[model samples]
Target: MTEALLDEAGLVRWGRSLGEVAAREAVFVALSGPLGAGKTRLTQAACAGAGVSEAVTSPTYTLVHWYTGGRGPVAHADLYRIRDASELPGLGWEELETRPGAVFVEWAERAGDELPPDRWEIRFEFAAGGALRRVRVCVRGCAPPIPDPAVYSAAPEAPSC
Candidate 1:
């Protein structure tokens, strides 16, 4: 596991770097955080890094959204509205798991034990008086390593989270 304190721009760069590497192979990323923690923003940056030309929006209500990028396919799902893990299958959870390229799920803890064992988990916490985010990344099974946002130099300020 690794952790870093990142401003909004740093968070985006870190997410983009993660996407660049993850795009090389199929991977599942689970994002867990409270509201306004920047889960969707990170996903958008990652999709951009993967060469997704279209806008990447949160599937909070839609549940799931799919797009084809230069690297391959990208699937973004939000489980915020899900009341139980048992409800996932109705949303095509099985099919989403088998998707190629990268799959990102927000409010992923809502899935409980139903999530794949081999995956990456990222958690975000408000920090520095909510001016920054404390991000933690961990791997399960044979999941690939994640980039350390601390390695990136300070980036210009971005819109507040």
Candidate 2:
């Protein structure tokens, strides 16, 4: 489940595909990337791919945003301001695992080990040459092997109706 997507369009295509696969697990997705590297863009695309009808926005200032009613609820969180894992539980981190919907966390590196194990680890890479970006998707703990970020494959089955 690893490869290399080229530009914005490629990233969106891959995001949509990944979103479809992610819908099956119904778990959380942690996005790791620097500012302005397209984390929110990919998230929005993924939500759309998951049939999210409402707007998908960055929860920077608010810390979290909730979207429900499409397939199910989607809890989007940006933990950039969080300094320690202790603070997460207060923001519903503990409930994330038990919640009926999926979750998407931005600046997940900040989550540290607090990040749930059974989830997608997505890292965005912006090459030195241009505005084009690359996204790498890997399961947690399977990290070291994914040396560089890659454009992984979708699990094949179409999204659930």
Candidate 3:
């Protein structure tokens, strides 16, 4: 998938949409964007859509935030303060390769050659007022296994007509 730009609300909507797409294919998202791009907001919206009910925030000091509710241990990482991007593998980066939940990384560009080839690359930027995010959800190499729809289903069915 190529890059597509969107407004702030559109970015949030895109997050929700990406969650839906990953609902069937465990998604490991890497949020790549500058400051004030609404990366955390987008992540929050996506997680909420996927069943998370807690407050999502940046892990600047902590480095990583694991949210468990509906997505089942969704992890969010901010590499902005990372000293050596090559140290990712040692930080359990391999987990995202085969998980159902997403591992959103802000400032993923710092990872350089460390990032896998299949994870989603979400790039966010500042627009006129709010923000604009361009997303490229690609799952070709790492192939993070897709989770069954029933796992993230909200309402379930009312019986087929």
Off by over 4 Å in 2: 1-3, 141-161
Total backbone collisions for each predicted model: 0, 1, 3
- Cα lDDT tens digits, model 2, 1-161, are 55454577766776665555555446678888888887888778777766788888788887778776355567788888888677787776777777766678899888788887777787777764655765666776532332223433222345699
Worst 10 residues of 2 by lDDT: 146-155
Clashing pairs in 1: none
Please report the TM-score between candidate 3 and the true structure: 0.70
Rank the models by TM-score, top first: 1, 2, 3
Model 2 TM-score, 2 decimals: 0.79
What's the C-alpha lDDT at position 31 in model 3? 73
Superior by lDDT: candidate 1 or candidate 3:
1
- lDDT of the candidates, in the order given: 0.85, 0.70, 0.63
The true-versus-predicted C-alpha distance at residue 36 of model 3, in Å, is: 0.9
Local distance difference test, candidate 3? 0.63
